[model samples]
Target: MELLLVEDDERVSRFVRRGLEAEGYSVTAAQDGVAGLSRARAESYDVLILDVMLPGLSGRDVCRQLRKAEVSTPILMLTALDHTDDKVECLRGGADDYLTKPFDFEELLARLEALARRGRGFSSEPPAVLEVGNVRIDRQSMRVLLDGEPVELTAKEYQLLDLLLSSPGRVFSRTRILNKVWGYDSDPLTNVVDVYIRRLRGKMRWDRDTGWIRTIRSYGYRLDPTI
Candidate 1:
């Protein structure tokens, strides 16, 4: 599933993005309402998660504008406001659903799944296979193949590779990678991400100079853009 998350809180964004990714949802995030609105307009997603309190424009305003523009994507609003009036206001402004602050991750997941179902009339899923260059993964089987040959990968390695494959050529910072592949609660100083990257590279037979996985010095990694 592809999701647009509009949130200004780094901690909250990191938390939700990681949790959803771990469950195999692809996420694109915007830190403020302006960027969020732009992304919503320019791209397509299975669902959108917008925080009520945002910089530049509020989530309600964003929702209203999207409706006015006929975007029609299912929207689930997030707000610290728990009152009936607040919930009603969100629905009135065109939100499909509403979640109160400090929500249970499970509840959020359920709500997202519900919205997806409501939109598609059934459960939506990621693509059956994701391929970039010679590497590909079967979303259902969680199996990877390189050049028609099966390759073995640990769970974490598979996740790291999946992340890289999801956005070919897009640079992912070490911190973002760590938070996505690992949990947001992981130790920030750990070298675990580097270790996993090396493991994935070796198993995939990554070429140091021209492999799909390229390391950005002092930054992080990305799949080869030209591939």
Candidate 2:
């Protein structure tokens, strides 16, 4: 995932950038709130980590401005303040989450993952590669392969596959899939899902022993890793 970190604290920013990069994320960092806000407005990122205290502008103001500009990216505020009021203020200013200084890196990572997944039906964290059975998907390159053989897919097909692979076995209802993947709710007259499912199965060469996309009768579909 592409992330923008807005922090004036050099030590903190470097720490986060290094950690996230090691975990396969593309990170761009800004040192001050104004610069950070400018970058956020001019570019698209999967997530933003903003420090509460910064030169020129406060993280709260940056978040508020981003929201005003209709930028829906998730914002995680980093603050040394630990009061309940501080947390409330961050949320009130349109921040999605906040981390107290001296916080556990693991916890911060978890929160980042959670915030990043808010609108997308992806794995909690941004993943470079996803694997199920012999099927492998390289998220960075948007390539799919089965047992080392490349598989070509249409744009929509690839998106559907990516959603399923995001969380194996997380049963996604037809309506949910329709909204998430198709960008709309399900319609009784539409058989688009069936058509895509059939296409996916055929393209993936699914068989009884390798049926990764399992139909949960009367409900929806799930990626069965066991299959």
Candidate 3:
């Protein structure tokens, strides 16, 4: 997934860009709010990570402008402030999710994933059926079967699987997955995608027994090639 990260701190920006790239995401960084806004307006992105305190424009202002301009890309707001009013202000300004500094990378990734899912209009209601390779996901009843046997999956695991199956062979960056699955705005230092990929492999990819959900290696993930 393509993402725009608007942050002023060079150190923070580099750290985040590296982390997101490691998770196989394509990220564009803007040093301040003005440049960030310009980049956002100039291109299409799956998500935006905006810092509350910006040089040219505040994160809140950027969100406000985006909303005013009818840019529907999901936004995750970042800030060091943890006050309730501050959170409210950002949300009111149009941020989908808010995060304070010193956050758990895992939690941030989860939030970002959740947001992406929401943006894609994924149904909370279970699906009737999901088929990927020899595995089948029954959304209506929240059941998964591999090789005709029941397979256990955690809630997050099921969500991730459903996401992959829904878009077979489409590359999904770590940031994209994080927003769609976890509902957060940004995570610059998390290896959450790798962690979850490992978990999914353990559960779904049984050696050569199952061959779905291939990693693109430094890009993201895709479902079985056949879609």
Candidate 4:
């Protein structure tokens, strides 16, 4: 797989590049945001490893521009900013995943593999239809099936469901959800996420007797595993 590694730290860049290359991925390294964004727009890559800080333009900006340009390449953001706000910002900015500094290489590789699999529209295990009770999620077509029937969802709803179903049983805070489904630096007070989640639940549970999206009171929400 072709991978783009955008980082300014020379030592960290070299270390990660060698590790990924050793694992059989063709690695391209860019030391600054401008060069990284240029390479990203110029070529097709399977995944991007972007550092939050760069010489010109932030990684967040690069991610936003890539998404704006409709590049579907999976992005994994790397940074020393471990604050929840920072992580949320990156996700909202268009990153698929976030990793703090001093991370384990093994975990990073695993996350990259997962992102690759998702990008290729394949899961590691057998391809079984995903169902949350009566609601079915068609991974192949990015469509929702309810009661064996198709249910229409807006773009935002689809994205919200995708995020929740991708990591079921994991409680995602409002901030994190905002980043993942919206974009980084979105208005934190906006009820857009809640509205979309309610809409999704309304459609998904229309024919079912139970709810799939469970609210965690003040924390956030999560997909109930038992559903």
Identify the leading candidate in terms of TM-score. 3
Distance from true position, residue 11, model 2, in Å? 1.1
Give per-residue lDDT, candidate 1, residue 37.
Answer: 96
Task: Single out the weakest 10-residue window by summed lDDT for candidate 1.
Answer: 179-188
Ranking by lDDT: 1, 2, 4, 3
Candidate 4, superposed: residue stretches over 4 Å from native: 126-227
Model 3 Cα lDDT, one tens digit per residue, 1-227: 78899999898888888877765568999988889888888899888999999998998999999999999999999899999999999998889999899776656666776777777787655458977777788888889987799988988888888888877766777767877788764488887877887788788754423556677777677776432
Stretches of model 1 off by over 4 angstroms after superposition: 1-78, 97-123, 225-227
- What tens-digit string does per-residue lDDT give for candidate 2 at 93-163? 89888889988765776687787788466655567888878889998898999889999999889989998
- Residue 186 of model 4 has an lDDT of 45
**Which of candidates 2 and 3 reaches a greater lDDT?**
2
Q: What is the lDDT of residue 13 in candidate 3?
A: 85
lDDT string, candidate 1, 79-159, tens digits: 889999999999999999999989977679779988988877763666789987777799789999988899998889988
lDDT of each: 0.87, 0.85, 0.81, 0.83
| Ten residues in sequence with the least summed lDDT for candidate 3 | 205-214
Q: TM-score for model 1?
A: 0.60
User: Which runs in model 3 stand beyond 4 Å of their true positions?
Assistant: 125-128, 139-227
Clashes of each: 0, 0, 26, 4
Query: For every model shown, what is its TM-score relative to the native structure?
Result: 0.60, 0.57, 0.66, 0.56
Best model per lDDT: 1
